[model samples]
Target chain A: DVKVTQSSRYLVKRTGEKVFLECVQDMDHENMFWYRQDPGLGLRLIYFSYDVKMKEKGDIPEGYSVSREKKERFSLILESASTNQTSMYLCASTTAGANTGELFFGEGSRLTVL
Target chain B: GESVGLHLPTLSVQEGDNSIINCAYSNSASDYFIWYKQESGKGPQFIIDIRSNMDKRQGQRVTVLLNKTVKHLSLQIAATQPGDSAVYFCAETGSGNTGKLIFGQGTTLQVKP
Candidate 1:
C-alpha cells in the first residue's frame, strides 16, 4: 500500500503570512499532486509533480506553488496566505497516470487563514 | 472550459438499499474516469475506475458504468451502509501522463438506518 503523509491536519495562519503544506510518500511513485477541496467546487488541482524537481501548475494555482526537491517528498507553498485560501488541502500520488490506476491520497490538511 | 459535474448534489437512501450516483463530463477526449469517496475530514479515496474503451467495471461492492456517447458516468453501490455515506466525486483525465484529474462537483450520499 502507498502511504501519503501530510505535515498538518489543521493549520491556521494570518493573511499575508507565508504558509507551507508538506506531503511525503513512502512508495517511490513517479507522480505527486496537490489539490484544494472547496464546498461547492470539488477538488481542484493546485500543482502536480511528475518527477523530482519538476512541477506543473494545475487549474487553480494562483495563490500556491509547489516543490519536489526529492522523489519521496512534495511540498505546497503559499507565498502569501489569504482568507480565500482557507480550505481543505489534499496530497495524492500514483505510480503513473490513470491507465486504470488509482491515486493514493493522504488524510487532508484543513487550512484556516484569518 | 471542459470539466466534470454531478447530476445531484445529494442523495439519501435507506440502509441496505442500493445507491446510484451520476456524473456528467464535457470533455470528449477524456479517456479515463474515476470515482472517489471522501468521508468527513478525509481526502478522497479511490472507489473504482473505468477506461474509455470499457463500458462498465466492477469492484468490491461497487460498480462503475460509463457511457461514452453521453459522456456520463455512474457509480452503483450494493447494500449501502452507513459507512457508504460520503461525498462522491467523479474525475476525468484527458491527454495527460501526470495523472491530472478534473473532479466533478461531489454528490453527498446519506444512508439512513
Candidate 2:
C-alpha cells in the first residue's frame, strides 16, 4: 500500500512566525505537490517538485516555498505565517511516467495562524 | 483563463436515494477527468476517472459520465449513505504539461438518514 505521511496533523502558530510542513511518501514517486484548501477556492496548488532540487510554481505560490532534497520527502515552508495563511495543507505524490494524473495524498495538515 | 466549475454548490439526498452532481469546464483541450470525494478534515479521495475516449466509467456504487462536446462531467452515487456525504470535486487534465490538474469549485453532498 502507498503511504503518504504528514509530520503534523494540527498546529497553531502566531503571526509572523515561520512554519514548516513535512511530507514523506513510501511509493518512491517522483512528483510531489503542496496545496492549500479553502472554503470556496477548493485546493490551490502552492508548489510542486518533479525531481530532487527541481521545483515549479503552481497557480498560487506566493508567500510559500518548497524543498525536495530527497525523493521520498517534500517540505513546505511558510516564510511569515499570517491569518490568511491559515488553512488545510495537503501533500500528494505520483509516479514519473506517462499515465493518468492520479495523485495519492496524505491526510493533510491543518494550520491555524493567529 | 478557462476553469472548471460546478452547477450547484450543494445537493441533499435521502438515504438509499441516488444523487447526481454536475460540473462544466471551459477548456476543450482537457481530455481526462477525475472525480474526488473529500470528507471533513481530510484530503480529496479519488472516486473514479473517465477519459475523453470513453463516455462513462463505473466503480463500486459510483459512476462518472463525461460529455466532451459540452465539456461537462457528472458523478452519480447510487444508494447514497452517510459515508458519501462530503464535498465532491471534478478535475481535468491533459497532455503536454507537468500533469498537474485543474479542479472545479466543488459540490457539497449531504445524505439524510
Candidate 3:
C-alpha cells in the first residue's frame, strides 16, 4: 500500500504570516502536487514537482511556492498568508510507471488565515 | 477555458440502490479520467479510472464509463452502502506521463437508510 503523509492536518495563521505545509510519500513517486480545494471551485492546482529540484506553476500559483529537496518529500509554502488564502490543502504523489496515472493523496491540511 | 465540470452538485440515494454521478470535460485532448471519493475532512481517494481507449471499466463495486464523443464521464456504484457517502469528483488528465490532472467541482453523495 502506498502512504502519503501530510505534516499537519489543521493550521491557523494571522494575516501576512508565513506558513508551511509538508507532505511525504513512502512509494518513491516521481511526481508531487499541491492543490487547494474550495467549495464550488474544485481542486485547483497550485504547484507541482516532477523531479527533485524541478518545479512547475499550476493554474493558481500566486502567493504560493513549493520545494522538493528529496524524492520523498514535497513542501508547500504560503509566502504571505491572507484571509482569502484559507483552504483545504491536499498533497498528492504519482508513481512514474503507468499510464493510468492514479494519484495517492494524503489527508488534507485545513489552513485558516485570520 | 478548457475545464472539467460536474452535471450535479449533489445526489441522494437509498442504501442498496445504485448511484450514478456524471461529469463533463471540454478538453478533447484529455486521454485519462479518474473517479475519486472524498469523505468530510479528508482527501480524495481513488475509486476507479478509465483510459480514453476503453469506454468502461469496473472495480470491486464501482464502474467508470467514458464517452469520448460527448466528452462525458460517469461513475456507477452498485448496491450503494452508507460507506459510499462522500463527495465524488471526476478528474481528467491530458498527459498522464507528466501527471497533470484537471478536477471537476465534485458531487456530494448522501446515502439514506
Candidate 4:
C-alpha cells in the first residue's frame, strides 16, 4: 500500500519561532502538496511541488514556504510561527502522468503555536 | 475568482437510508470532480470521482453525479451506516492543472441508528 508519513503528528512551538514540518511518501509520486485545514474553512492549499526544486504557491501561501530536495520528501517551513497559524497541516502526493488528479494524503500534523 | 461550495452545511440520516450531499462549482472549465470523506482528526479520504464527460459514476456503495449545465455535484451513499458518518467535500480540478484541487466548504454527515 502507498504510505505518506509526516515527521511529527503533534507539535507545539512558541510565537515567532521557526518551524519545519516534514513529509515523506514511499510511493515516489512526482507531485506533492501542503495544505492547512481550518474549522468551517476546508483544506486550503499552501504550496505544491511537481518535481525536485520546483514549487508553486497555492491559494493561501503567505507566511509559508516549501522545499523539495528529493523525490520522496517535501517540507513545509514556517518562517515565524504565530498563534493564528495554529491548525492541522496535511501532506499529499500524486502521480505525475496523465492518468488523472487523484491524491494520497498522510495522516496529518496538528500544530499549536503559543 | 473561482470557488467550490456546498449547498448544506450539515445533514442527518438514519441507518439503512440513503444520504445525498450537494456541491457547486463556479469554474466551468473544471474537468475533474472528486468526492472525499474526512473523519474527525484524520485527513480526507478519496471516495469517488467523476469526469466532465460522464454525468454519473459509481463505486462500492457510493455514487457521484455531475451536472455540467449547472456546475453542480452530488454524492449519494447507499444504506448509510454509523461508520459512514463524516464530513463530505467535493473538489473540482482545472482542465490543464496537475492535481491542483479546489475544494468546497464541506458538509457534515451524521448517521444515526
Query: DockQ: which candidate is best?
Result: 3
Per-residue accuracy of model 3 over A47-70 as CA lDDT, tens digit each: 998899999999999999999999
Tens digits of per-residue lDDT for model 4, A1-109: 8899999999999999999999999997999999998878888999999999999999899999999999999999999999999999999999896535578889899
Tell me the deviation in Å of residue A55 in model 1.
Answer: 0.8
The parts of candidate 1 lying over 4 Å away from their true place are A97-100, B96-98
Best by TM-score: 4
Flag clash pairs in model 1: none
Model 3: residue B104 alpha-carbon error in angstroms: 0.4
The CAPRI classification for model 4 reads as: medium
* Order of the predicted models by lDDT, top scorer first: 3, 4, 1, 2
Q: State the weakest 10-residue window (summed lDDT) of model 3 chain B.
A: B92-101
- Specify the poorest-scoring 10-residue window by lDDT in model 4 chain B: B94-103
Say which prediction, candidate 2 or candidate 4, comes out ahead on lDDT.
Answer: 4
Candidates 1 and 3: which is better by lDDT? 3
Per-residue lDDT for B94 in model 1? 63
Q: After superposition, which runs of candidate 4 have C-alpha atoms over 4 Å from their true positions?
A: none
Docking class of 1: medium
Candidate 2 total steric clashes:
0
Candidate 2, TM-score of its B chain: 0.96
Query: For candidate 2, lDDT tens digit of each residue in B3-67?
Result: 88999999999999999999999888777889988998777888899888999999999999998
- The best-first sequence of candidates by DockQ reads 3, 1, 4, 2
Q: List, residue by residue over B1-113, the lDDT tens digit for candidate 1.
A: 88899999999999999999999999888889999999987778988888899999999999999999998999999999999999999998866554688899899999999
TM-score of each: 0.96, 0.96, 0.96, 0.97
